[model samples]
Target: MKQDNITAKREQEKRIVSLMIRTYCKGRHGTRQGLCPECQALQEYALLRADRCPFMEAKTFCSNCRVHCYKPAMRENIRAVMRYSGPRMMFSHPVLVIQHGIESIREKKRLEKENHEA
Candidate 1:
């Protein structure tokens, strides 16, 4: 049961990150169809990280995660993608943005409580 939950969370993270990368690639790279080669590589790397995330059960999103699992260069690349894609997500994926915001807040509160307890 715990494994199932972790798998679901991982898949959801992958889906959201993939969407963000696709949006960034299309808007920035002017790719009319699927992701360009560069974005595709980034997407794959992001998904692999998500798959291996140790804090998947606790973290709501990569932005809220304290541990940086991504290598420096890939982390910078993902940051660029998020910066370009985040505001745009309001127009393209408002629901996801809202949900992510809510989840981040909840996760922050949960972590605070854990720290306070400890």
Candidate 2:
């Protein structure tokens, strides 16, 4: 595959991972609980995107700076796509679920491969 295709595919998978994190955080998942006032505000700001995240303050801190806390280039892509497509994904595409599932499985395999190689 060409370099651009790899980058684009990585970008899409990054979006999928980010979506999973947000959804997991929103619902019951891990054993841990509680969010700091800053993280809480950040979460809401993340959801409504009303303002910048206090915990991750800056309009583009993670992705722009390539923070280790987030997968490289993912934060921006997720923010951009969700900002535009969240509602559309809900009502427009009937294939959204299947597409997401397949992408997720691929991402998991990719991660496993990378980990094994490392």
Candidate 3:
């Protein structure tokens, strides 16, 4: 049961990231259809990172993770994509945006409580 939940969470995360990348590519690269090559590559890299993330079971999002596994360049690229697409997501994917926000808040509270206890 726990494993199923983890797997579902991972898939959900991948789906959200893919949507963000596609949104970024379409907005920035003027791609009417599928992602541009660069965006596709970044999407793949992000999925790979998520799949192999050691903290997947413990963390709500990569941003909340204490350890940064993405390379510096890739991290910056993702940051740019998020910055561009995050606000737009409210229009294109409001449900996902709300869910992500709730999860992030929960994670923040969890971490703060953990720190206080420690």
lDDT of each: 0.89, 0.45, 0.91
Q: Which model is ahead, 2 or 3, in terms of TM-score? A: 3
Return the candidate ranking by TM-score, descending: 3, 1, 2
Cα lDDT of model 3 by residue, 34-91, tens digit: 9888999899999999899877777887887789999999999999999999999999
Off by over 4 Å in 2: 29-94, 100-118
lDDT of 1 by residue, 8-39 (tens): 98998899899999989998999999999999
What's the ranking of the predictions by lDDT, best on top?
3, 1, 2
User: Candidate 3: where is the Cα deviation over 4 Å?
Assistant: none
TM-score of each: 0.88, 0.32, 0.94
Off by over 4 Å in 1: 115-118
| Candidate number with greatest TM-score | 3
Compare candidates 1 and 2 on lDDT and give the better one: 1
